[model samples]
Target: MKALFIGGTGIISSAITRQLSETDGCELYLLNRGNRNESLPANVKVLQADINDESQVAKLIEDLSFDVVADFIAFRPEQLERDYRLFHGKTKQFIFISSASAYQKPLSDYRVTESTPLANPYWEYSRNKIACEEYLIKQYREQGFPITIVRPSHTYDERSIPLGVHGSKGSWQVARRMLANKPVIIHGDGTSLWTMTHNRDFAKGFIGLMGNIHAIGEAVQITSDETVTWNQIYAAIADALGVKLQAVHVSSEFLAACSKEDYTGGLIGDKANSVVFDNAKLKRLVPDFVASTRFDQGVKQTVAHVLAHPECQTEDPEFDIWCDKVIDALQGAIASVKGR
Candidate 1:
């Protein structure tokens, strides 16, 4: 089977490309921005095209017909609409990489399934994904578009620096700070539960769906069954790095108040809490789909990777600015309380 991967150069997509290349009887093709071709297999055909350009994408798809198209980075509605039209009647299967963020969460609720209502107020990200899923399903019903949607939780590879658990800047920042012997910053009392998945396992689940007729017209949650609190996750990382998990936990109430002030550009509270996903549907489809890397194991791998590659250890500027604003608001709040 000829499998074409769009956005195949990403961390998760790289894993998927490797898996496809290793699988016998399957040939892999990659269509990416062509920025990072080093990790890709030499035998795999590479097509350089800007995904945002419809003409470029359409021209490429017309020439190289694929049995399956795994889109790793279709975030916006325009991107999805264009890609859907380009591959509408041509491809056998259209696999979309969606996110658990598509569903609104009160982590305490736990066990959210594919059918759960998506409560995304800031739909810029989640709404667009949900919209694309809806569009694909519509196509499946009317035009028989073989669409399979996979919603993965916080997927981490050795290279991943996920922001949900490690703060807005991601775990990479924490790893860098730990390397510098600085205290790790914890947002919102360090009590939120995080559901993280290994990128390898996530890639395998994506591959497992290939050409499987049962997976078509269905959405599956690809994630680890276990849930870990933020404090525990940080402690595990600290243990791995042989550093004390000395973190300054910020109060959610303070953050909410800070998000309101102009100086801090308003506070952003944890709208989602203690949330977990039910991947029973996916497990039933791919019975042997088990996450091999535990949270601690994944953390260790990520830390080791960061330690090995100093170049990969850069801070996210946006997150740093946001953190600075929050800290400013926090100091202001402390002063106000003292004055009162």
Candidate 2:
């Protein structure tokens, strides 16, 4: 079968392309902005086009068609709409990559199925993804556009890092800090439960679901079955690195008091005790889906990747600023409380 993958330059999509090329009887075509094509397979065809531009995308699709279209980076509704306009009738199936954040629930719920309500309209990223999913489902039911949605949990490849106090990056950052023998920074008690999935496993499961007719019009949560707390995650990383887990725990009340002036920093305190998602539906859909890499194993792989490729280790400036803000808030709270 012929497959056209959008945003093929990313780490996740690159793995998918490699897997598809190795599989017999599968033809792969990558449609990217043409920025990073060095690691792509020689046998895989490349199409240079901006997916955000409707005219260029439509023109590209005028002559080319595929049995399956896997979109790895459809973050905006406009992008999804452009995809629908370009390949709605031409492609046999559309597989959209969604996030577990699309589900509005705590992590401790034990199981959040496809039936979970999506994030509220105020969350820009999750809301946009849900809107795209809703649009695709509507098209499939009314206009017969074959569509499947896959919601992956925190996916970490060897190249990823935890950046700051929040987000997937933040989690990785905490792990890195622990690995570095630095104190693990905890905003509030550090009892929040979360899960991480290796990108290669995620990509494999995603590809397996591509042409499965029964998967159409369904949202499958792709994640590891293991659930862990923030403290446990830090301890695991430290243990893997052969280091001690030294943590500086801050109270939630202190963080709340500091948040009066710095809301973003204080918000991290609340997330400390939150449970994010449950991936039971994924297990049921792909009963054979087994996560080969554990969190510690994944962390070691990530550390190796960072050590080998120094360029990928540079921290994002925005994350640095956010971290500074949180630190400042914490310091101010300590001083204020001491003065009282």
Per model, state how many residue pairs clash. 7, 9
Q: Write the per-residue lDDT of candidate 1 for residues 1-340, one digit (tens) a residue.
A: 8988888877678788888888889988888888899767777888888878888778777767778988898887667778778887778899988878777633335668888876565435676787888887787898888889888877777775554324453456666666667655565677777777888888778888888888999998888887888787778888778887767667655554444222121112122266677888988898888878888988788778877887667676565455566666666878999995
Cα lDDT of candidate 2 equals 0.70
> What is candidate 2's TM-score against the reference?
0.84
Query: Would you estimate the TM-scores of all the predictions?
Result: 0.87, 0.84
Show model 1 residue runs off by greater than 4 Å: 106-108, 163-171, 252-272, 316-340
Can you write out model 2's per-residue Cα lDDT over 167-200, one digit (the tens) per residue?
3233445545556665655656767566767777
Q: Per-candidate RMSD vs. true structure?
A: 3.5, 3.9
Off by over 4 Å in 2: 105-110, 162-181, 240-242, 250-280, 315-340
lDDT of each model, Cα atoms only? 0.73, 0.70
Which ten-residue region of model 2 has the weakest summed lDDT? 261-270
